[model samples]
Target: MRSHLLNDTTAEQYRRSVTEGVERVAAKIAATERPFTGVTVDALAPRIDGIDLDQPLYDTTAVLDELEEVYFRDAIYFHHPRYLAHLNCPVVIPAVLGEAVLSAVNSSLDTWDQSAGGTLIERKLIDWTTARIGLGPAADGVFTSGGTQSNLQALLLAREEAKPGRDGLEGPASLARLRIFASEVSHFSVKKSAKLLGLGEDAVVSVPVDTDKRMQTLALARELERCVTAGLIPMAVVATAGTTDFGSIDPLPEIAELCERYGTWMHVDAAYGCGLLASVRHRDRIDGIERADSVTVDYHKSFFQPVSSSAVLVRDAATLRHATYHAEYLNPRRMVQERIPNQVDKSLQTTRRFDALKLWMTLRTMGADGIGRLFDEVCDLAAEGWRLLAADPRFDVVVEPSLSTLVFRCIPAAVTDPAEIDRANLYARKALFASGDAVVAGTKVGARQYLKFTLLNPETTTDDIAAVLDLIAGHAEQYLGESLDRAS
Candidate 1:
């Protein structure tokens, strides 16, 4: 039937398939009553494993019917208000439309000829973001998969820049002396990137954080001085614009001054706080970001866009040439000589998806200000949730949020034993997830178990927070009671 090819004969079939698929998705979204359906891995795995791929259904309806039972029935819905889990956002509608178009067209954004208009669109969006970040005229960037890749690329550039002048003995000996500094609370990707870059685990030095969980600049200055005395090269100082667990933003202005003084590269991981670029009122939070050598921004995390919307911006555009590779068949030296705008020249990837269209459509439909307001809404909700947690006396709310995440653990006044409280909090989180009424996240701080409420949904109200808090408290008390019964 040549159904795979999208020619004139298969055009009607394509339209019908899209209509049916979207209808099913819409129905699923509308019918989802909970954030999760509480289906365990053991129960779901067998159903999926039982599907005989050799036996083809040969009909889209039959395939979708099987998918409904195996996948859609228990899928977690991030759009639901009760989903106070991860950094997943309920995406804006325009981005969803962009996804449909990009998927059908299947544009590859590596070379100029393959993309053309797609390349220009991505460049324009990068320019817009750079302007918003105030990275100056020489600033340039490229869209990446997410923050991890962006951070890796940023550190790679820093390592290349940190190379010692050749004196006939500059191979492994000099590379071993290179060190990267980051706050203890910074993303784990920093250490992982160091290892991938052949620097090993010892190359990363963790700087201490203050009581507010922000990196202490004075300690950082001291570390830099120590590095100079020890004949170690400080390759990069990675500052966190938003930490995952605490949502605390390190003091960037002070850190930037330290990096300048030490002649070290500054890389700001603004994956979670990049929404401030659009924030009219709170943009000052990332004031020193423009001074950074490089910055990582994940629009997917905070811009109300779907997954895979992120970019790595560099202050001096020439720095991106560090990632450039001349491929014979793709972005060759001849293309560079011709001044062709091949995005692959600045990317760590070859066959990249046109993920920028999602952000472009989102910015066009809901202007930058609209996304900022949505971000502000969630921050406001976090404040309310914090107040509720603080007043209830059941939860030991960690600190006031700098963004939309609250890290706290259940600790009723009656539960005096610290160990028991920790166990109870852990038990409560699992019980809530197993019940499937709501979904929340968990983390640990200083060997103590903590429950996290990453409020990314602006639609999630104080009422929803209260309901989840009630569930947490109930489960905690029940767990404690059960433990006491077992003890007796």
Candidate 2:
């Protein structure tokens, strides 16, 4: 049993195994030739099914070799320059070091005894972020799993604030009358949160968006007025700091003013655009974020940190008490009276990871200005990509991007029909992915299917964007030709 523990006798073996494993992984990441290997479910499923879980390989090297064959060989490489799909960012090196350190220690951040200084580290990071958002002195926040969890927790707090005394009521009639206002383009989590909170889907009222995909403030104002007129409660206004598909930010100042007038809780889902907090030149893009009652920020999405790094920040610290349940075995009343910081009090989770260490180490090593510069680079690349698409006659570029996402569709000269163009673009996206030449995203803009480029890699340049665009065009043309031949 003592041999199982990492003591003086086993330390050398443990160190060798861990070091070799890390080096192998780093080598693979460094040697990856493409952003994706186009490994399909049908191909990988058989290999995965062949694994014998009950049989343990005594040799660590043999286990690692099997891992390489089954997992690492075809894993999607977000660090690759051509990987332009989704909101995944290439992580910073310091954050990777933080992950290694935190994982080895296995610190649980739920209580002071469980985490000790880990609790302070997370709280310090939260305080630093809240200061950047200008949430004032009373602001507090807790690290969450990701943006979805953060959004759910934010809405939970909003619900508690909206109706303080209706927790154990008979029927959810009051909850049914409560409405959440958000843009038509906002994240799906808002409606999901409502459902989980017993407000039902109908409680979510979708406000219309403008041409740029940002929320229309006038429409929101009118909707709030209508809610008031109907004797309905406008519980919260959910604003999108950066929408998923288009990366469009709503008019936060105007929306915040409307929320203030209507006495509604304001929650901004800034998961994709939270990097604006560190942005040096373009911080003004998220100008009114400071006015939000609560904001969800995903460091993984835009801060170039690993996954599970995000937080839900509240403007007033007292609002976090809504999530507190004094467990006798955990954070008891006496502990609170003694002013010990138990993070479990504010978080939706009891067993939480010290995810804040990643961001803290990243900020300390890379500096906030450096992170901002990296984000600016990607935004600049998107602007350049927009110009390239706008000039090309084959592609129909959407509105100018407010952030690092470009949503557009293919409309080659060969495809005259609207439905045919949609099919062609969809086919091109799928073909491109299957070929593994590039990884791009796709979404539906109204009724038409559009391809998207979500650039989060600072290393990617205009030439790389042009190459991917050319590939997209070639795929679209090939698809159209194939269709024509089939018709003939």
Kindly list the per-residue Cα lDDT of model 1 for residues 311-353, writing each as its tens digit: 9999999989899999898878998789999999999999999
Report RMSD for candidate 1: 1.2
Cα displacement (angstroms), candidate 1, residue 421, comes to 0.9
What is the C-alpha lDDT profile of model 2 across 256-351, one tens digit per residue? 999999899999999999999999899999999999999999999999999979999999999999899899999998998899999999998999
Misplaced by over 4 Å in model 2 are 1-9, 165-171
Report clash pairs, candidate 1. none
Alpha-carbon RMSD, each predicted model: 1.2, 1.6
Give one clash count per candidate, in the order shown: 0, 0
Please list the C-alpha lDDT of all candidates, in the order they appear.
0.91, 0.92
**Model 2 poorest ten-residue lDDT run:** 164-173
TM-score list, all predictions: 0.98, 0.98
